[model samples]
Target: MKFLDQAKVYIRSGDGGAGSVSFRREKFIEMGGPDGGDGGRGGDVWAEAVDGLNTLIDYRYQQHFKAATGGHGMGRLRAGANASDIVLKVPAGTQIFEEDNETLVADLAKVGDRFRIARGGNGGFGNAHFKSSTNRAPRHANPGQPGEERWIWLRLKLIADAGLLGLPNAGKSTLLAAVSAAKPKIADYPFTTLHPQLGVVQVGNHSFVLADIPGLIAGAHEGHGLGTRFLGHVERCAVLLHLIDVTAEDPVAAYRVIRKELKAYSPELAAKPEVIAFNKTDLLSTEAIEDKLKDFKRRVRKTPLLVSGATTMGVPAAMKKLLEVIDASRRGDRPADAPGITTEEWRP
Candidate 1:
C-alpha cells in the first residue's frame, strides 16, 4: 500500500469487426442476391472512481490497458458480436490529463464518477447494404475502422475539511493523533512522517475530515525536504490548522518560515482560513509558557491556542475551537474567526 498520487498510462480501444461478403446460393434459388452481414462495433475504454482506494500505485505496475476486439462477421446474414469494454477503477479525487499533462480531460471527485477515455471504432458495412436494383450482384465489403488510443496522466488529491501545516517536528502528527483516530508515525526526529495521513474528528453530532501533511522546510517550494509534492493534498481543504512548537528557540521564526513556504507554493493556500495553535506546552513551565504566549501575542497581535498533544492537556479545548472554526467556515463567513478570539471561543 505504498502511497502514490501520480501515474501515467496508455489506453487503447478495440477495433471494429470486418464485414462479410457472401451471396445466396440455394438449390432452388439460382438468381439470389448478396447476403453479407454487417460488422459489430468495437469495445470502449473507460475509467471509473470507486471507494476504498486512496492511491494510484496500482497503475505503476501496469501501464497499458486495451479493450477486446469485436468478432468478425460471418456468412448467411450473421452480424458480428460486440467486444467487451475495459473499465479502470481509480480512487476518488483523481484527475485525468492528456499527454501534455496540461489539458484536463476529467476530474473524478465523487464516488461512482466515470469517464470514457477511448471510444470504440464503428462497424463496417456489408455487401448486402450496397445491393440495389441497378447493382443486384454487389460484391463490395468495407473494412473495419481503427480504434482510438491515447496516453493519459492521473493525479490524486486528498479531500479533507481541514489540513495541518507546520515545519518539521512541529507536533503536527502528535496533534492529529491526539484529536483523531489516525496514528501517524511520530518521533523526536524531523521528517518522521513522510506522507499525508487522514483522520475523522467528531464533535458532538458533527464530524469533519482532517489531513496531516508531511512537514515542510525552508526551501520546500524548490524541492527541499519532500518539497511541495504533497501540497496538492491541501488544496481542497476548507481550513488550515497552523501548529507551531512553543518550545522552539524562536517560535515566531518557525511560524514565519512555514508561512513563507506556503505562500511560495500557493498563494491561495496561504489565503485559506487558518487556526494557529501553540503546541508542546507541557514541555515548558507555567512561567516559561506564559512568557512565550506573551511574546507570541505581542509579535503577531493574535492570541493562539495553547495545547499539549503528549499529555492531552488543553486537547479538548483545542478540538472545540477547531470545530467552531470549521462551522464558521462552512457558513461562508468572511475571515471566519478573528484574531484574539481564542480566549472567548474556548470555554474550557
Candidate 2:
C-alpha cells in the first residue's frame, strides 16, 4: 500500500430492462389477450465506509465502476429479475466531492456509513399493462430507462483527538514515537516522514488517538514542499501540539513560520487549541533553555513546556498535559494551560 488520500473515479448505474411484447396463443384459446411481463429494475451504485482501510490507493488503478443491468422481461406474464447492486468500499472519513471538486457531496465520518452515488433506472411497462376492454390486442412495449453516470472525487481526512504541528525536523516524529506506539521513520534531515501516522495513547483507563502529519514549511499554502496536502488530516483534531526545536538558531522564528503557514492554509486550524512544547531540550544547556523559555513567554504571554524526546525528560508530564487539554476540549471548555485565540465560531 502506497498511501493515496485522494482519487477521481467515474461511476455508472445499471439501466433498466426492456419490456416484452407477446400475446397468449394457445390451441384451445384462439382469441387470447396480451401476456407480456414487466421489466426488472436496474442496479444502483453505492459507496460505503468500512474499517481496516486508511488509504484510497485502490481507486488509482481502477477508475471506472458500473453496476449490472437488469434482465429483460419474458412472455406469459413473467417478470424479469432485478439486477444486483454494486457497492464500493471506502475508508472512513472519506469525503465525496462533485466534478467541480469544491462542492461537497457526502462526508463519511463513521464506519458503515453509505451514500448512493448513482441511482438505477426504473423498469418499463409491458404490453399487458396497456391492454384494456377497448384495446384487447395491444402490441406496444416501452424500453427501459438509462442509468445515471457521473465523475466524483474522493478525499480522505484522518480523524484524531490531537495532532502534532511543526516545521521540518522539529522532533515531532520523535515525540510521537516516544509517547505512543507509532514507529514513524526518523531521520536527521527534513521530510523523513512522508505520510501521516496515527497512534493510540492510553492514559490509565482512557485512550485517545494522535496523528503525526508531515512537517510543514513556509509557502505551504502555495503548494510548496509537500504543500498543504496533509493539513486536512488535522482539521478534525480537537487539539494541536506545537513542537518547536529548542536547538534551532532562532526557535521563535521557526515557530512563527509554521504558524504563518497554518493560518494561511486555514484560519480555523490556527484557531484550534494549541499546546506549545519546546523539544530537544537535551541538546541545550539549562541556561539556554531558560533564556529561550523566557523569550517565548514574553512574546506569547504563556509558559511553554520543555521536553526531550531522546532522553524522555518531561515526556510524561507533556502527555498528562495533552490529556488534560483534550478532556477540557471535550467538555466545551478552553484549556487553561495552553489556550488559542478564537478566530471562528465553534460548530459543535
Candidate 3:
C-alpha cells in the first residue's frame, strides 16, 4: 500500500430516532392513556489504532465517513432499534487533530488505542414521559437530537528507538541496510531514498528499532527540499545517528547545515541525543581521515566515530553505542550524551 502520513476526513455521528406519538387503543378499554415509546439512540463515531496498518492510504480515497442513523419508533409503545457504531481503524502513532489542525483531539501511540471522535445524539422521550397528573393524554412527542459533524485531520508518525540523519548521499541508508534487514534504496546520486524506512538493529543481546528518513537541506524548516515533514517520523526516537560524508569538502559545514534545520524545525528535536559518525571512510585515506576527524572534533566539540557502511567497518561499535543510549533512555535515565524530547505533545 502507498504511504500516506496525513489525511483530512469528514466524519458525522448518527442522528437519534424520533419518538412515537400513539395511545393505547384496546377494544376493552374505554379511556386510553398516552403509551408512546421512546426513540432509540443513534450510533457514535470512533477512531481506533489497530495493528497490521502503518499507513493512512486508505483514507485517501474515502474522505467522508458517517454512522447509521437510528430507526424511528413504532406505534403502540414499540421502541426503535439502536444503530450500530462506526470505528475508523488507523495505524499506531496516529494523532487526531481538529479542523484547525492545531488542537489535538487524541494521540494513539499504541495498538488497540481508541478515542470517540463524535458522540451519537441522545434519543428523545416519548409522549408518556410528558404526561402528568393534570394532563391525562398527550398528543405530541419529542423529536430526536441531531448528530454532530466535523472535519478532522489524521497524522501518522512512525515509532522507532533510534533515527538516522544526514544530508543527501551521506550514506544514512547504507548504514541502516548494513545493520538491519531493511532494504532501503541506495544510489551514487542524492535523494535516492524519498520515503522514510524502518529497520531493527541487533547489538549483542539487545535489538532496537531504527528509522531512516530523507536528508535535510538548508531552510528545511521553511519547506525547502521536501521540508521537515518527514522529520515527524523520528521525533519519538531516543537517539539520532547523524552521518556526515567524509568525502565531501568541509564536512563540518555540511553537519552544521543539518543541525540548523533540526533546530529550526523543533528545538526538542535539536536537543535529542546525537551520535555523529563520519561515513564513507573506505573512500578516504588514513592520513586524510585522521585530519578530517580532528577537524570535526574541534568544530563539533565531540569525538566522532568512523564508519564505512559499504564495508561494514566500525558499524558494530556504532550500533553498540546506539544500544547503550537506547537502554539508558528506556531506563528513565537521561544520559548526558543522549537527551531527547520528552515533552513533545504527541508522537506525530
Candidate 4:
C-alpha cells in the first residue's frame, strides 16, 4: 500500500429527531390528554486507534464521514429510535488536529485509544411534556437540534525504537536489510528508497522496531530533497543510528550536513542519542580505512564504528550498541552522555 502520513477529512454528527404532536382520540375517551412522543437522540462521531495499520492512505480516497440521523417520532406515544455512532478506526500513533492544524485534539500513541470528535445533538421534547393543568391540549412540538460539522487533520507518526539517518547513498537501507527482514530497495543510485521502511531487530532474546527513512542532504530542513517531513517518524525513537559512507571523499562534511539538517528541523531530534558508524568498509582498503578513521577521529574527537552492511562485517557490534541505548531508554534510565561504540578494524 502507498504510504500516507497526513490527511484532511470532514466529519459531521447526526441530527436529533423531531417530536410528534398527537392527541388521544379513542372511542369512549372523553377529553383525552395529549399523547405526543419525544424524539430520539442523534449519533456521535468518534475516532479509535486500532492495530494492523501503518499508513493513512485509506483516508485519501474518502474524506468525509457523517453519522446517521435519528428517526422521527410517531403517534401513540412512540419515541423515535436513536441513531448509531460513527467510529473512525485509525492506526496507532495517529494524531487528530483542528482545522488550523496547530491545535492538537488528540494523540493516540498506542492501540485502543479513543477520542470523541463530534457530539450528537440532543433530542427534542414532545408537546405532551408541556401539557399542564391550565394547558392540557398542547398544539406545539419541539424541533430537532442540528448536528455539528467540521474539518480536521490526521497525522501518523511511526513508533520505533531506533531510527537510521544519513546522507543519500550512505548505506542506510543496506544496513537495515542486513540487520532485519525488511526488504527495502537497494541500489547504487541516490534516493533509491523513497519512503520510510520499518524492521524488527533482535539482540539475544530482546527485539525492537527500527525505522529507516529517506536520506537527507544540505537544505533538507528548508524542504529541499524530501525535506524534513519524514523526520517526524523518527522523533519518538529512543536512539538514532547514523551511517556515513566510509568511501566518501569528505565523510566529515557529509556527516555535518545531515547533523545540521536535524538541528534545523528540531532541536530535540538533534539532541537524541545517536550512534555514528562508518559503513561500507567492503569498498575500502585497509590503509584507506585507517586514514579515514584517523581523519574522522581527529576532527570530531569521537570513535566511529566501522561496518560493511553488504558483507555483514561489524554489523553485530553495531546492533549491540544500538540495543544498549534502547534498553536504557525503555527502562526510563536514558542518559545524556551515552558513549558511542568503539571502532575496530573491519575487513570483508
RMSD of each candidate relative to the true structure? 8.8, 6.1, 4.5, 9.1
- How do all models score by TM-score? 0.89, 0.92, 0.94, 0.91
Local accuracy by lDDT, each model: 0.85, 0.87, 0.88, 0.89
Give per-residue CA lDDT, model 4, range 1-348, as digits (tens): 999999999999888889889898999999988888888878888888899999999999999999988777777889889899898889888888999988978877788887788877766778888899899899989887888899999999898999999999999998899999999999999999888999999889989899998999899988899998899899889999999999999999988999999999999999999999999999989999999999999998888999999999999999999999999988895456432221122111
lDDT of 1 at 153: 97
Q: Sort every candidate by TM-score, greatest first.
A: 3, 2, 4, 1
| Model 2, position 332: C-alpha lDDT score | 86
Candidates 2 and 4 compared: the better one by TM-score is 2
- Candidate 1 residue-wise lDDT at 46: 84
Q: Alpha-carbon error at 79 in model 2, in Å? A: 1.5
Which one wins on TM-score?
A: 3
Off by over 4 Å in 2: 331-348
What order do candidates take by lDDT, descending? 4, 3, 2, 1
Q: Which residue ranges in model 3 land beyond 4 Å of their true spot? A: 333-348
Runs of candidate 1 with Cα error greater than 4 angstroms are: 328-348
Collision count for each candidate, in order: 0, 0, 0, 0
Native-referenced Cα lDDT, model 4:
0.89
TM-score, model 2 to reference: 0.92
